[model samples]
Each structure stands twice: as structure tokens, then as C-alpha cells.
Target chain A: MADVKDVDWDAVMADSRFQSLRRKKTIFLWVLMVFSMTYYFVLPLGAAYFPHVFQIKIWGVLNVGLLFALSQFVVAWAVAFCYERRASGQFDVLAKEIVVAFHQQEPRR
Target chain B: MRASRAWSSVILCVISVLVALMPNVALADATVIGGEWRALTLTVFAAVIGLTIYVTYRSASHVKSAADFYAASGSISGLQNGWAIAGDYLSAASFLGIAGLIALNGYDGFMYSVGFLVAYVTVLLVIAEPCRNIGQYTLADILAYRNDPKLSRIFGALSVITVSTFYLTAQMVGGGVLVKTLIGIDYEVSVIAVGVLMLGYVIFGGMVATTWVQIIKATLLVIASIVLVMLVWVPYGFSLPDFMADVVGDPKVQARVAALLGDSSTVMTPSELGQRFLEPGLLYKMPVDQISLAMALVFGTAGLPHILMRFFTVHDAQQARKSVLWAMAIIGGFYVLTLILGFGAAHLVGPAAISAVDAGGNMAAPLLAQYLGGGRDSFWGNFMLAFVSAVAFATIVAVVAGLVLAAASAMAHDLYVGVLRAGRQVSSGQQVAAARVATLIVGAMAILIGIAAKGQNVAVLVGLAFAVAASANFPCILLTLYWRRANTAGMVAGMVVGTLVAVGLTLVSPNLTYPLQKIAAANKVLDAEQAKRTAIEAVLQNPWPQSESLIVKARAEQVALDKAIRLAQADIKKYEGQSRSFMGLKEPLISLKNPGVISIPAGFLAAILASLWIRDERARAKWSELYVRQNTGMGISKSVSH
Candidate 1:
């Protein structure tokens, strides 16, 4: 509800640290994407092709597909945890900075 | 020479060691598989069709303007709209899939119930108002906004096609499976019938007819589900918890429960699987599958092209929000009934009844009612299951129609009219004609996919679609709502990546290997034996020695595999006591034959990344404020034409 156009885009972009951090964030994201897909999509394929390739004997009762699918649960929890704190926080800030900058620029226009 | 080749002995020992573990063996039992009831079935189906058509025309009279045709205008009351949302949301996943999962998986089937319920929290909190507030026609209005109509058109078209194809696939499969088994209509014809019927609903009355049909069906289904649940629990005395505890405590039930809890080792041979549930595993404790299913539930509802489009029919964001909340209540109640249905199948009929009713455990609930109410031969009982099955068929048919309508709307309204024609004003007759023709075309498209996926598990494929929708659309739609930093580049990136990963996952996943029913029938005796041997060998070895010539194993190698299995089961148990848990969790698998639960958040992760990627400076500045402000001031319907 606040006037987002009144925030300072010039001051926000002037900060060089956001630029350095953005580059690191991009690299980290690509790495995250690869690992997530491997477990969620790729490993499931491997498990199907050879069901026994990845069996843990104590888990001998559980099939590889079940294990793989279940990891999604763990990953999801970890991901959600990370997101609520790290990703959500960063995005919220990023969002705030941009919205405020737009608010600031509007009065000048 | 014998001494020099000693290295071969070691190598052979290692190979044999690995080879011994390769095959899983389990016991065998006989199962009586049943078909959908025909004579009693068609009468019920005919009745539903008659009802839907009568309601269709009755509702059509309400639509008199372009606004009326496209949005169903403002005639739909909140209760009607909410019921319609329930009708739309049920899809294959809620109706056929969850029921089937319970039939097969036992208590864990409730995971879907939970996933669906919890996701609405996200929906109510994150999506409902924003979607109602931000855009119209499709997700495109929100995502593309004032920048590019072309972009909106592209994304809208893609979203519609993906959702429609997947939705249509499930409906057609449900129809074909029912028809082939029911009145013995060919599967292809069943699919065609569904496609045409759906197109007719959308083409004749557009959203108005579709909305009323959904409301009517949702009402019937919810009422039926409640009645069925109450009936199941009442016979065991009026005490619900006691009945459940009694069911849980039974040894036969407990064994199935153990198998369910056991996780990986519990793949049932065709025989052991009959009317039995495998145990639960560590997977249960972690709630991973709950996550995957939950992601599907949360993201799937939000991103559904048809469901999202339905909100446009409402006048304001508040109405849309109210509609969603009411729909959630309806959905929650329907799912609770399903929990009764699943446990009832497990509790009352045992695994035997479901194994008799349908090859997949999905039929457990219907079978539970059929068996409990009395066998199919009982005059009233004959129609109970037949009624459920017929409604199941209609449910699929309704869903497929909604999907085709959504796709058709995209092709006609956004693509043909909005994009190609631009500022040119087409006549109302022409617009109506184009929409009908597009419906026909999309209808044809649905029929084709449905036929292609004919014999496959309709529910699993629907889950696959949930994965794709969660991956591709949810991120773009949700992030654009709250995250002002989100830009066009980021939105585009997320949609593309999410879709690619989802489709890729589906291609590689176990779905392809598992749905072998449609292929030319192999000697099920040998296949069943292998399934039996695999279920057996999974545990240890054959407890039953060479038996009489009744059940035959085809290959000679199977005999050797059986011996090795006996050796391993003996060796493993002798070495490790039965008292221990693995990694402080229950065993990971209860049954290999039936996959009951999957953690579904990978799809959401795709969404999260895609949402976070927008980097363009200028676009980010303008777009951020637009999300919260636009709908608060402009109203939802105003953006529909724009």
C-alpha cells in the first residue's frame, strides 16, 4: 500500500556490493539446479534402469525408487528452511530496494 | 592349470555375490481381478449425461454478453462458484488417483489428503488475492503485464497447451479404461467420446455451462463420498476410533502394515500382494513423499490454466479469494471422506477385495463399498460400485472438457483474436464461431493424447503433470505477485527451466516401466511368477520347495535365481538381527510393486529458482509496484479485455 515510487533506485544501484554478490548468487544457483535435478529427475531414471544399483541392505526392504523419491522430502525440507531464511530474506530485500527505488523516482517524474 | 585359474574363482565368487542380490523374491498368492460393471453402469452414466446436459442448457440462458460467454459474467453465486472450483480441482489426482493410492498403499494414501489441504494455506496466503488482483484470461495477464502482449500470448498458449494435454491425458485414460472394461467399448472410442462431450460443453455454453456442470458434479461427489464413509464406519459400531483401532490391530492388517512400514524389502510377489498392504518405512518418518505430493497440490492448483482462468469469471479479487477458501473447505471434506474410503478398503475388505476389483489398488474404495454394502450380485450393491464407477467416468469426462475449454480459450481468445487480429474488431458471431472451432481442434488434440496414453496409470501421469506445472508455472506466477525485483527475463527463465526438468523427470522415472498393462499380454503366469519370484527373492528365497505343476516359472534361470534368494535371506537374517532399524529410521520400502508416496518438492524448487532470476534493472523498477496496486484499484474483470 505504501508509495514504492518514492524509494531510492539511484542510491540502491550505487552500492557496488550488490553487484559482487549477484555474480556469486548466479553461480550458486546453477550448481543448485544441477544437483536438484539429478536427484529429482536423473537419479530416478538410473534407479529404474537398474533397480538394484543403489540399494542399501538395511534399506533392503525399501526399493531404490522409493529412496530417491523420499530424498525429495528431505531436500524439500532443507530447501524450504533455506528459502524461508536465506532466499526469502534476500528476495524480500531485493524486492524492497527495487520497489522503494521506483517510489522515489515517481515524484521526480 | 586349475591352480593358475584360481583368480577366476575369486572373480566368479564376487560376480555370484553381486548376482545373488540382483533378484528380489517374495511369496505368491492368487488374485481375482474384476472389470467395471457394464449393464448396471451405462444406465447410471446415461443418467449423469442427461443431468449434465439439462443443467448445461439451463445455465446457458444466463450468458447473454461477451462478458457472459467468456467470464460466465457475474451470475455464479459464491456457493456455486466455490463448488465449481471444487469440481475443477478434483481432476484425476483427487478423485481416481488418491482413491487408487489408498487402495494400494493403506494409511499413507492420506499423504495426498494432507498435501492438498496444506497447500491451500500457501494458496490462501500467497496466491488467491494476487491472482484475482493482478491479471486475466490466463496467467499471462499477470506475468507479461503492460510490457508485451506477445509474451503474454506465448506464455498463455504454452501454459494452456501443457495443462490441457496433461489433464486431457488423465481424463481420456480414465474414460478408456472404464469403457474398455465396462460396456466393452474400444479404448479409442472411449477417448473420442470424452473429447467430443467435453468440447460440446465448452462450445455450447462456454464458461457458464462448464461452471454449472462442475458445481453439480462436485455436489454429487462430495455427498456420495460422505455417505460412503459414514456407511463404512457405522457397521463396525458408531465408534470411529475403536473401529480404526480394531482394523489396525488385526494380524492380517498388521502384516500388511508391517510390509508397508518395512519399505524396500517388501516388494510383493503377485500372490503375496493380493488383498495385502506392504509395510511403512523410514520414508514414512521423514515425510518426504508428503512434500512432493504437497508441492504438486500447492503449485498444481495455483498454476492450473483452467483453475486460474475461472477466477476471471468473478467480479473482484475478494470474490475470487472467497471462492478459493470455500473450495478448499469442500476439497478438504471430500479428501477426509477418501481417507475413510482407503482405510475402509484396508480394514474391512482386506487386500483381497481390491485385488479382485481392479489390477491397481486404486479401486479399493469402490470395492470397499461394493463388498461391504454386499457383493456385486446384491441388488442394491450392484449399483453402488457401478454408480461410483460411472461417476468416475463422468468425473474424467468433465475434467477433460474443462481442459479442452481452457486450451481452446487460449487458442481462440488470446492467440487468434488478441494476437493475430490485434485492433481489428471481429463480429460477435465470428468470435463465437472461432471459439467453437478452436474447442473442436483442442478437443481433437485431447482425444489423441488420451488414446496414446490409454493403458498407462492415469493418476501417475497426472502427478507428472503436477510436477511439470509446479516446476514451470507456479514460480513465475507467485514470485511476480510478491517479488518486485522479478523481471521478464527471470520469469521466462523459470518457466522454461521448470518445464524442461519436469518433462525430463517424467521421461526417466519409473512410470514408463510400471504401466505394462496395455502392452500385448505376456504370459502373466510367467510374468506373475517373475513378479512373485522378484517379490520373494527380495526377502530371501523360496520357502516353498518345488511344488506341483500348478503355478509355473517359465525360465530355467529362475530356478537358479530362486536358490540364490534362499541362501541370501538365510545369510542376512542370520548375520543381522530383526530387532534393529536402519539409520535410525524404519526400512525404506514396504512394497516395490506399488509405489504409494513420492516427495514432490523438486518441482517447487524449479519454481523458486526461476522466480529469483530476474536481473534487468529498468523492468524490475516498473513491475514491482504493479503487483499489489493494480488489482486493488482496477478490478479483475477490467483487465480481462485489456
Candidate 2:
């Protein structure tokens, strides 16, 4: 546990780095969340609303609907990969720095 | 007392297994159930039981503390946790049910699998990290952090218990039917055995045992599915087009399908039939219900108490994120295989044989496994069938263990410790004891419900559970983390109203029974007529002492009854059409089979409006603390080191 009591909450809250990390993460996650949600809804929506369009044969047995549904697995994997990259690379580093700063200043208080 | 109860249940499981193995036991009428494969299937089942007993014993010694019991001492790594998550998440519903659905209803079943996989994206991006950072043991911990602990714990415990119990019942019922059909065990015995095993896991081993059970089950399930897929693919030269073409051109498949459609006279060309099967409208005719079900799955997965509770088992936010990523890969890959499994069953097992065994097509996967191993008479065929059945049975037991543990945690940690004790400090031993006792109660309730729901469609219950989770649980958890203005009243209103509306809509909706009730009524009458015919035919077989006139009259009556029975069966098929609603109504009160589309938004809106409508200063005051901790992972407990 990070010794929540000794660290100064008001100061940490005002830290510019902490503020930036939160903003960046919030925007990145929401955008990803929104995009994934929209991309997913398209499968059910297209299959239901435009049956003829989705029925267009793309291959011997594969139709547009089947292909679209299969593509979702790829898309979900891609989204997870992207989020993992960003989270591990950028978000965790920034959050770790904030944690370090608070802990380093705790003894001086 | 609790220990004795647990022992008795285990004894019951042993007795039932013994009885099921006895020679010349009364078998079900279904040809699929028991024949020559009983030894192999029971051996496989015994192996799984042996594994559970060993794992639970090992975990029991380590489960001395509350943390050990609840979060497996936070020792599970990302990879193992990922597999466990897959095991817990992929119920027999996904493995057996969806594959069967795909085999029976082509494109629509694949659509369901898509939503299931894509739902993980929501979990990864939103729920995983924050939940791990802010919560401990139960989901209620997260809420209690920023709101009134008592109020939040109470509601949280209530929703968790409700969702988990609803989900547990579905698994228990599915387990019962699946076991009975595959091995010819009685449904009551199957339900009791499953309940006993699940209770043994949760009561003795807690999360650690549950996690390992899930991990082992998941590995077995995935490997079995891959092997099945490969076996299926080999016959078609590993070519997709070849498989599709064969599936379409196979005369047996077409005839069986025609029979299933109840229109053998009107035969479409193979290509046209292929087009119809490959298209999207076979099972789900309603676009609205599709959208509703899709929404529920994508949102509801994030809110499942069992899934969410997994995060607490990991050490930190980063591990939690990694676990979800791992889960996504395994689950996504598994779902892709389901397409082949489904289509393969349709091609190999034939729809006629599949439905002849179980109407819901639940037997498609297992039967397909048998066929790919060379048909029912072959040794390899029965061995492969028993393997898949055992893996599926393990799948159900693992999932139910997770659910029972989650509910017990809510009952013990959230309700008893947090609310009843008013957040007083409880000894670790006492907490563990409470959880064990809670497991017994919950397991008993599930067993009774599973037995009572025998032969009834519990698929609706699964849908209802998802809708409730999405509507009631998701909105509150999401708002608590994001919305600074979210207050206790708003959260309360959201849960109460969300649960009410979702459940209310489902009760009135076509999901309860529209055509199903009407068809079931017709079936009852048809069954009686068929039974009467069978009796007369039996009497006619021994007519040496009877008069010729009587024998001739009985033969004539049997012939007439056959025609009457066929007509009655066709009458039942007529009610299969979805255009007609329940209770003689032209349309259902709510046409959407899943209530997510309406109820999910209602939950969010209620929370938002209630928050905006009412003010709570204390909640707003604590937002900064929660915000920092959630984002930075500060104050999160380390892995318990005992």
C-alpha cells in the first residue's frame, strides 16, 4: 500500500503532471471506448437493416455479414493491442512518476 | 455444521455417480443419452472430480485469511488469471450453447459470438484498471470508498447476490441438462452432483481453488475445441469453400433440414438453401432484438460481479490490464473456432440427428465430436464424445464456482462485515467462516432452483441476468468512478429502478413465452396421443390369446393415431412462428427479447438525473481523493504475504 496518510493530497491534486496524466488517459480511453462501441454496433445494425447489402457474396460461402462478424475479432484484438501499448508505454510511466514524487516528498513533511 | 453439510453434499455426489454407473439403469428415451459409452464418460467425469478434490485440498491450507479466501492472496499472474477469466467467462453457454446455435442457426449464431468477444474490449478499456486500483475483495468496496460505506455496501451486496444467483441458476440448469443428455444420468442427480462439486470448490478452496479450476477447465475446453475444429477441417481438405460447398450439397443435411423446417415437399435448390443458411435471418428475425441483445452483451460483461471480482485477485492495475488483454486473446480465438464447430456439426452430425437428441441443438458439439471420431459405433467416437462432454461439464462447474464465491463474498464481506457490523473490524478467521457458511446457503438454493427448472428453457434467465447487470450494476459502477456529482440516492435509484425495469420488461416481454407456451401446450397433447398409440401397439404384439377382431381393430387404431400424431406435431410447428405473440396478443408488450436497449439507457439517465436533481456535498468533496487514487494506483493493497 502507498501510505495514503502521509502524502499531501491537495498538493498531489494540483500537480501539473498528475493533471496531464488524468486528462490524457480519460480522453484516450473514452475515444477508444466510443470507437469500439460504434464499430461493434455496425455489425448488428447493418445485418438487420440492410440484409441485401450484407448478403452480397464476397467469396464462395462467405457473405458480407459473415466477413463483417469475423472482422470484429480482429478489430477487438487491435483495440486491446493499442490500449495495452499506450497504457504500458505512456500512462503507467506518467502515473509512476507522480507516485514517486509524492513518496519522495513525504519524509520532508 | 457447515463442514458436515459440505461433506454430505460430497457424499451425495459420490452416491449419484455410483448410481449413474450401475448397469441396466432406466435410461431416457433419447437415443443420444446412454448406450455403450457410459464407462468412458464416467471415467472422464471421475478424473475431473479427482482434480477438483486435489486442488481444493491444496487451496484450503492456504485459505486461512480473508484475503487468501477472497483474492487468492493476490498471487495469480496475468497469464494464469487470463485463462481463469476465460474459464469463468466462457460458460457452457458459450462453448456448448453457442456452438450448437451456430450449427443449428448459421449466421445468427456467429453474430452472438461476435458480441461476446467484442464485449471484452469494453472491459479492458474501462473497467479493469480502475476497478483493481479502487476496490478490494468485493465490488462494493469501490463504491464504499467514495459514498456512504453502509449504503453502498448494502446495494452492492444486493446486486451482486442477485446477479450471481441468477447466473448460477442458469449454469446449474445447463449443467444438469447437459450431463443428463450426454451421460444418461438423471437430471436431479446431475444437478445435485454439479451443486455439490461447485460448493466443495468455493467452501473449501475459495478464490484460489476456483481460479485454478477455471484455468484448468479453460485450457481443456480450448484444446478440445481446437482439436474438434481440426478434425472437422481435415475432411474438407482444410478448405473453407470446400466445407461450405459440402455442407450445402450434402443430401442428408438438406433432407434433415427440410424435415426440421416441416416442409419436405417444397425443396429449394442446394445453392438457395445454402444462401439462406449462410444469411442472418434464420433464428433472430428481429433487428431490434438483435440490437438489444448486442447492447446488453457489450455493456453487461463489464458489470458481471464474477468478472469484476477477478481484478481484485491480481496485484496491481497493470497486472489487471494484462489479464484482460490475455482474456481477450483466448476468448476471441475460442469464439472464432465456434463458427467451424457449429458449421461442422451441421455438416457432420446433421440437424435431424442433433435436434432429435436435444431440441435446442445443445448436443451438436458433442455429437459432432463423436462423428468426427468415426460415428457412434466406433471406440474413438465414444472416447471423443466423452472427452468433450467432460470438458463441458468442467466448464459449468468452474463457472458456477466463481459465481458462488462472488455471491458469498458479497454476503460475507459486503453485507455482514461492512453493513451488519457497521464497518467494524472482524477477525480474518471469522470472515472466512462467514463466507463458507454463505457458500452453503447459496449452493443449496442453486441446487433446488436447478432441479425445479428441469426441462424448461433457462436461456431467458441468462439474458435477464445480463440485462440486469448492464442496467442495474453497470450504470452505478461507471458513474461512481467518473461522475463527481454522483450521489448515494442517484446510485440507489439507478439500481432499484434499473433492476425493476429490466426484470419487469422481461417478464412482460416475449421472452417469458409467446409462441413457446403455445407450442408447449400442443406438444403436451401430442405426447399423450403418441403414448396411447405406443401402449396399443405393445398390446397388439402379444395377440396370441386375443381375438382376431380385437387385434385388427387395435392395428387400425394404431394407424389412425400415427396420422393424428403427425398432424398434431405439425400443429406444434405452426406456433413456432414469431409473428404471433404470447397470450393471444398480436404483439408482445415489449418485442425485444433482451431489455438492454431500453433499460441500460434508463439506468444511466436515472443516475444522471437523480444526481443533477439532488445534491450531496460529501460525495463531491471526496472526488479528488478517489480520482487520484484510481488513476495513480496509490493506496491499493499489495499482494497478501501472510
Candidate 3:
């Protein structure tokens, strides 16, 4: 029981039920990474790069920094919602398949 | 009765609107309990749990095997582990620092919250499953999977010591600060108290008690913070703008708070001109420091030695992953609440909330509670303040206990038994005893350090630890998982170099400078006012019944001295003679150089270099033995440790 180790990558990819789930997980991961990396760039560059903060005034008052910050909250919320939705259905199905496959593996020769 | 209740609220809303529309000095002075409540809450909570953990670990420890000590026999539920992660990860700096920062700087504080959340994705996608797949007991287990026991043990021991020490110092400092604030004990006493208690807890009960205590603290803190947030947001009903408006309307409150925060104001006053030196600009100023600070949060959170160790407590990789997600959820909510709590304090209490009279208020949230809640002179109000303060202390203790355990475990289990003399098994009882002794040593060290750095930024201490972990530990672990040619030599170099560079840079970095406070202030004098004259003036005023004219002259002199001192502090001329700054390179590109202040990014470039130094091993055969053994125990990972 203690000897279990390694993944059957071939079987996981070939399995029809798991394929979409795997793809979704990959996409989700990348999306999350992009958002974060983008976040790093945003904080450093927002004041310099964005003209909205300097030039464009919304309602004759609030400028670009405030707008950009406000948008960040919305974007974060959106990403979280996306994660919860995908994780509930797509990720869950994938996890089950992976776990099931593991449990069913043949003993070592 | 219903109408009367409705009328009361309506009248209050009208009053609130009026207050927001004009500058009200009376409202600003409206009895701020100062920031004492956070300190108070911190003291109680830390005392209870710190003491409990220490006593339990020292006296009742029965850890016979490494499995018992490190994994708790893999008996903990994912949820329990999940909560413990929150308790452990949300160290004192997180609770007090993030909240206080936001109160002073607006949305920048929220940025810290997001940076923390983002790192989980990195962990979830890249590290978590692989870490679970690789080794048991510690990170060394994974890094040295293919190497000799001797090799693994060395790396493992090193990993344990470095990660545990870095994490523990942050925890101890945080605990000490909270204790000093809440209970009015000196910082030294607070540090010693925390260290002793944490050592005892780990020594007695090991993982079982640590897990339970952390989970309890996490839940309680989250609940309490959420309560405070809701009160601030919906004191009568939920209107976010109304709350902000109230904060904006009081100029005296704004001036006082703006002064206390130094250069954080969006709007500048002539009075605020002095603090402008500290106000970080968007990108170029402390750019490297800022980026490093953010990176420290993002990557450091993922690779913390103790945090990864807790993952082993769960049954499978899936459970570990689930626990991480759950922790993120709880912690995310808490961060949001912290924003509200901080703003509430700054708005309701102002800067006066923080004082020597009620030392705990430096913790921010308490200062906020007093502002939003009631009169400190009143019994019910004071009790509420005391309760919150106690809880904050407990939070610190919970965190310290976990860190102390991690460090102690390294010394006893990894260094002494595993590496020092390999193949000679130590009995569980012996292991527990060794761990207990180690705990005491670590606790003592933490107390000494914590006392030395009293009232320092809890956030910065935690950040430095994170920077070290991310630089040294993360690089090594990642390379081991993905890179096959990652010889033990390369791994060792990467880990050691990474740890040293990150730690060294952090110590010498520009962000270490606190606002407006500097070395020049310590050594120099402005105008003709000397220390002798100031002291004499004070003595003269006290001893004699001074004439009105004499009083006027003395007061004017005092005011002039204050102004001159402020002017001297504002402009510090630095002569950089052949100065190559900290990150081992000369020019820093990303720190706060202008307004809308952000940190510099020199640390990021350094970390990237540090990470790149670890080459990915390409040999597949390195994982062959493990490849065949994969499909068996609890079905976790088929991946190879590089």
C-alpha cells in the first residue's frame, strides 16, 4: 500500500471523459498566471503608461489612477467567479477521473 | 416602537450626511480609544494559544516516529489543515500590517491582498501536486529523492533550518509587538513570553495540538474581523459610499491621520510638506524594493517550509490542493475585511487612537474599533476593546507556535537524528524530547531578536522571510521537480546562494528606511537650539510660576524649534561616493521615485537571476525507480522529483 507512485500520462490523455477536464485545467492555470503576471506589470506601469490617469477626467473630476484601481477590483472578482464555476464542474470531473484511474491501476510485476 | 427605531436611524443618517459635507473638529476628537484594541486582542489571543502550545508540546509529547511528528499519522482532515494554514500563514504582520497600511494609503493596501491571492495559483498549478508527489516529512525529501540518504539528509536539514528560522523570527516579532501593545508588558517580556509558550506547545503535543490551535485561531480571527467589517459597512444599513464620505468630511481627523501616516495623503498640505520625503512615488523610486516586497508576498507564501509541511498532514495530493483552495477563500475574505476594518479605524478614530496610554492601538484595527464602536471610558465599550485585543494576541501566539514547531522539528528530527547519524533510528519518545529541547533554543533566539527589533514593521519582517524562501527554497524545489540534471551540487549552490542573496539584499535595501525618521535626525541640530537649552527651558517652566509674557515666549520658542527640526528632517542630502547599492547592482529601476508611491523592483531582477541559476535536469532515467512505484500508496503522484 505504501509503494504507490507515478502517473499513467498516456491513459489520462486517451480517456475521453478526462480530456476536456484536463484541457480546462490547463487553460485555467494559464489564465490565472497571466492575470497575476499582468498584475505585476500593472502596478509598476499604471502611473507611467496609462494616459487616462493624467489626461482623461471622468465626470470632470476623477482621473485614471482611480479608474484603473476600480477596474482591478472588477477584474479580480470576475476571475474568481470564473474559477469557482469552472472548478465546480469541469475540474471536479477531471479530478474524479484521475483519482479513479489511480485506484484501478494494476499491481507491479 | 418600529417607527421610533426607524426615526432614530433616519436622524443618524442625516447627521452623518451633514458631518460628511463639512469639516468637523469635534467629530475628529470624538473619543478615539486610539489603536489599543488590536494590541489588546493580539495579547490575549497570543497568550492563551502560545502558552497552551508550549505546555502541550513540552509535557505531553509522544511523537515516537517522524510520521507522528510531521504528518500526525496523516489523520487530519483537509478542512482542519485548511484552517490551520490560515492561522499559520496569517502571521502578525499580515493581521496588523496590511490593515494599518491601507488605513494610511488607500488602494495600495488592497494590492497587497491581491498579490497574496495570486501566489496560490502559482502554488496550485506548479508546486502543490508535485510537492505532494515527491517526498515525505519535508522539502528535503523531494529535493534529494534520487540522491543518497546522506545527500538528502543534508539538504533536508538545511532546508528545515533556513525556512524555519526565517519564518519563526517573523512570528516572534509579530507576537512580541502585539503583547507589548495589549498587556502593557515591555516588548522584551512579550517576546520572551511568546517564545517560551510556543516552545512548550511544540514540545508537548507536536502537530496534533498545533493543528487544532491554529484552526481555532483562524476561524475566530476571521469571524471577528468580518464582524468589524460588517459594522463599518452597514452600521445601520449597507452603504459603502456613506462610510467613505464620513471619513472624508472631518478635516481635523484628516490632518491628524495624515500627519501620523506621514506622506500618504492624496491631497498635500503645507504641514504635510515635511513628510513628502517618505511618500513613495509610482515606479522608479523604491521600484526594486516594491517589486521585491510584492514578490516576497507572492512566492514566499507558496514555499514557506512550515506551510508545505502541513500539506503532508492531508491524506493525498488532492486533499492538499483542496485545503489550499479553502485557505485562499478564507484568507481572501479576511483580507477584504481587513480593508474595511482599517479604513473604519482611520475614519472614526483618527491618529489620536494610537497612543502610549493605549499602546495596543498601533495595531490599527483596535484604533478603528474604538472609533467605530464606543467610548473607552464606558464599561461595555472597554470590554469590547479588551476582547478584541486579546484575540489579536492569540492570533500571534498561534502563528508563533507553528513556526517554533517547524524550527524545532528541523533541529531534532532532520539535523540531529536524520543527518548527523544516518541509519540509526531514534525512538519516537527520543525524537519528541529532542524536538522539545530544540524548541526552547529556537524560542530563546526569537525572543532576543524580537526584543531588539521592537515596534518595527511586522509586515517588513514577514516580507523579508518571504523573500528568502522564494529566492532560496522555491528555486531549489522547482528545479528538483522539473530539472533532471539538477545535481546535488547545483541544488546546494542554488539554495545557499538564493538564501544569502535574497536575505542580504533585503537588509541593505532602500525600503528598510521608515518614513521621515533617519540617521541625520539622530546626529545633527538645526538653528541655534541645543539639547541643553531645551531641557533648561522645560525645567524653568515647571519650577516657576511663569508670567503670561514668559509663557508666551517659551511656547513660541518651542513651536519654532519644532518647525526647524521638521525642516532639517525634510531634506537629507546624500553624497553617493562609489556607491553600488544592495541588489549587488548599481541602478534600481522600479522603486517608488514619484507620487502615488510604489516600491522599487530590484529584488525581482535578483530573484529571477537566482531562479535561473537552477538548471532543469533533462534525464528521464533519474525517475525510473519511482516511475514503477507510482500507482500504489493512497494514489497521489506519478511525477518525478528531478
| Backbone clashes counted, model 1 | 55
Question: Best candidate, TM-score-wise?
Answer: 2
Q: Which stretches of candidate 2 lie over 4 Å from their true place?
A: A107-109, B1-21, B24-26, B31-34, B252-268, B514-587, B638-642
lDDT of 3 by residue, B1-642 (tens): 342344335434433443342232223322233333433433444455444444344424445555666667666777888798888877666777677666555445555566666666667655765677566667777666654456656766676677677666666766665654444544565566556545545545578777877886787778778777877787637654456545544443344434344324424542232222112342123444455556666677666788877877776665666777777677767776775776576566653344323333345776555544566655446555665666676677678777777777667766787787568867766776677677778777777877776755444455656766776677666655654345455556666666666655555554454333343453364534586356537745686654543343344345445654655655344311323433444443333321111111332333345435644342234544332222112344322110
Candidate 2 C-alpha lDDT tens digits along B498-587: 898898888778766567666765677686885666667676888474664445445545554565576668757776666455345554
Q: What interface RMSD do all candidates show, one decimal each? A: 10.0, 1.1, 5.8
Judging by lDDT against the true structure, name the best candidate.
2
Error in Å for residue A3 of model 2: 1.8
**lDDT tens digits by residue: candidate 1, B207-305:** 888887787788778876877888877776765455555554444454444334333423433233322232232123334344445456656767778
Clashing residue pairs found in predicted model 2: none
Cα TM-score of candidate 3:
0.73
Measured on C-alpha atoms, candidate 1 has an lDDT of: 0.58
DockQ of model 3 vs. true complex: 0.26
lDDT value, residue B236 of candidate 3? 31
Q: What fraction of the reference structure's interface contacts does model 2 contain? A: 0.77
lDDT of the structure predicted as candidate 3: 0.57
